[model samples]
Target chain A: MDITNLESMPGKKIVKHLGLVQGSSVRAKHAGRDLLSSIKNLFGGELTSYTELLQESREEAMDRMLQQAKSVEANAILNVRFSTSSITQGAAEIYVYGTAVQLEATE
Target chain B: MSGGSFQLIYVIGLLIVAYLIGSYREKRHYQSIIKREHALNSLPAVNLKTAPKGHFQHELVMGNVTISVDYFKRFLALLHAFFGGPITSYETLLDRSRREALLRMKEMAKEKHAALVLNVKYETVSIFKGSGKSIGSVEVLAYGTALIPSSQAVASNVATTTQ
Candidate 1:
């Protein structure tokens, strides 16, 4: 599982040489926070609702990513990336992706 | 005597304006903090590094992040209206970006089957700058090495399953 081998497996179309593993989670409830935030705006105060939403979404995304790694029989995953997109007014999509590789023993 | 009273009144008005301006800046600072906290917490913990088992090989892992200044600026402005001072929006942005980059590096290592990442470094590049009232964007890059544990090299580390 050397990081260098992440993209360099021998005889391994990346599509075939590498396994396609994925994890995804949809999060809602940010809209409620956003609403509260607008109200707080008039009075000029802290927005606690958004704070909670962000925390919850982050955890859910991470959990999904881990499950993906386990499915690939990969003890380790490298070069992970995260992207966020709005699914709807109150919901968001979080995606985590990386290369999965098999480990070899050292001499 | 009336003129003297008028002058005093003018001075008091100027002081009030200054105080209001200062308070506005302070409010903006807190508002940015709240926004950044939201961004950071919204991001999930991701590890992509794959652990290498025996021999060590040098590897490269890269992570990139782009942040919108407009979103951040508005958050700060909101705070400024409530409080007053120069808001430190840039710092919060930097912190969140770094965290994201680091997490990416770790995920790369986990994917490669590396035990850990080493010799990590970071660089920041300005991708865009605000013109007038428009917002800007900043990019952050993180790179690191992924290594595997030596213990796995031994036969004992191999997993055997009964059929």
Candidate 2:
């Protein structure tokens, strides 16, 4: 499905509003990884382990969101947004949400 | 060696190393950011849902960055709590990461042949919380929708480059 963070697609018409579709995931690093991060933090740069963890979680959440939109027969998802929050010291939660709708080419 | 004196010595050593290295890295990152931002500034990323009047198709674009405070900043931040005023050190940390995230979004829009990105948004997540305190690694994600012009002249580049 086509996804855009605009309220309306620039060159397409929304034929039907399928409704809101959303997905979320909560994740945390293993103890070994968490310890490694603390050591890495001493130097201060990108935390590859955490970056990879969050990236994977975000993709999973987006996949679930898309699946929800597809279940509603939406061909497009609009006004998409993502949010990440810490559940605990070592854990994070990611959420993906959007408005689902059917579209028609506006040529 | 007395415990108290040893602790002070270790903390001081950490502060010196972290301050020097962090300052160096931040300066280099800023230079790179300025150069890339100058190029992507023309892409016009905004939060308006309405696309400017044009014959264009819309595409979603995203950029994300993760940044952490150095040992020095965190050490200073812990002390800032006692005074309870504006934590200036953390301010720079957040500022750099936020702008970095936005610049990345603009770069994404430019690469996709989008003239402008609309409805830009951002989300911040704390990746690591040190001892349940005020120091942590945070991730910032900036996203938007790009308006890709439909004119054949401009469209030719995207067509030839991607497929």
Candidate 3:
């Protein structure tokens, strides 16, 4: 499926609007990883483990969003957006939302 | 040595060490960011929702980074919070993270040989909230649609419309 953050896909027309499809994931690192991160925080630098964790969470959320689009018979998702919120002390929630639409080639 | 004196000395030592190392690393990161930004200046990323008229292949590209604040900055931030003034220390942290994320996204665009990226967007999240001793960290994500010029142009007979 074609996906873009733009409102409409270029060179294509939105044949049908499938409404909104959304997905979210809440994730947290293990205690050991959290401890390591705090130590790294002492010196200030990039947290590779946290980065990977959030990246994976985003992908998972996007996958679920795509599944919803697929279920609606939409060929593409448009105007996509992402948001992150701290749910608890250590957990983060990644939310992705987009408009599902059927696209037809103008050619 | 008395327990109180030893504890004070240790705290002071930790702050000094943290300040030295943190500033050094931050400087290095800024240097790298500037160098990469200069190198990637050719590839433009814009927030325009509509793609310019053309025959191109569009794909989604994204980059993300998570940066933790050092002990020194965290302490300064706390002071700033109490004093009600700008916390300059954390400013550089966020700036570096945002720039790094955008650079990484542009690098991805370069790898795909895309002419440019459109509809660029950013998401910033302050995670690992300051609780139970650990300080907070920020995560920045940059994403956009890469328009790669197609090698074989589609038939010109097709009517192209943008809405």
Top-DockQ candidate index = 3
Per-candidate interface C-alpha RMSD?
A: 9.8, 1.6, 1.0
In candidate 2 the C-alpha lDDT for residue A72 amounts to: 93
Per-residue lDDT for A21 in model 3?
Answer: 97
Q: After superposition, how far is residue B93 of candidate 3 from its true place, in Å?
A: 1.0
lDDT of 3 by residue, A14-101 (tens): 9999999999999999999989998987889899998999999999999999999999999999888999988776689999999999
Worst 10 residues of 2 chain A by lDDT: A39-48
Better of 1 and 3 by TM-score: 3
TM-score of each: 0.40, 0.89, 0.92
Pairwise DockQ winner, candidates 2 and 3: 3
- Chain B: TM-scores of all predictions: 0.49, 0.89, 0.88
Best by lDDT: 3
Better of 2 and 3 by lDDT: 3
Candidate 3: list runs displaced more than 4 Å: B131-135, B152-163
Local distance difference test values of all predictions, in order: 0.50, 0.82, 0.87
Per-residue lDDT tens digits for candidate 1, residues B1-163, read: 9999999898566546534543464457446545654644433232343433445544555555544333335445556646877556555545665765566556655555555565565666443334443224344556665554445423223542221
The digit string of per-residue lDDT tens for model 2 on A4-99 reads 877777567889998899999998899998898887677566677887788788889999999999899999998888988888877889999999
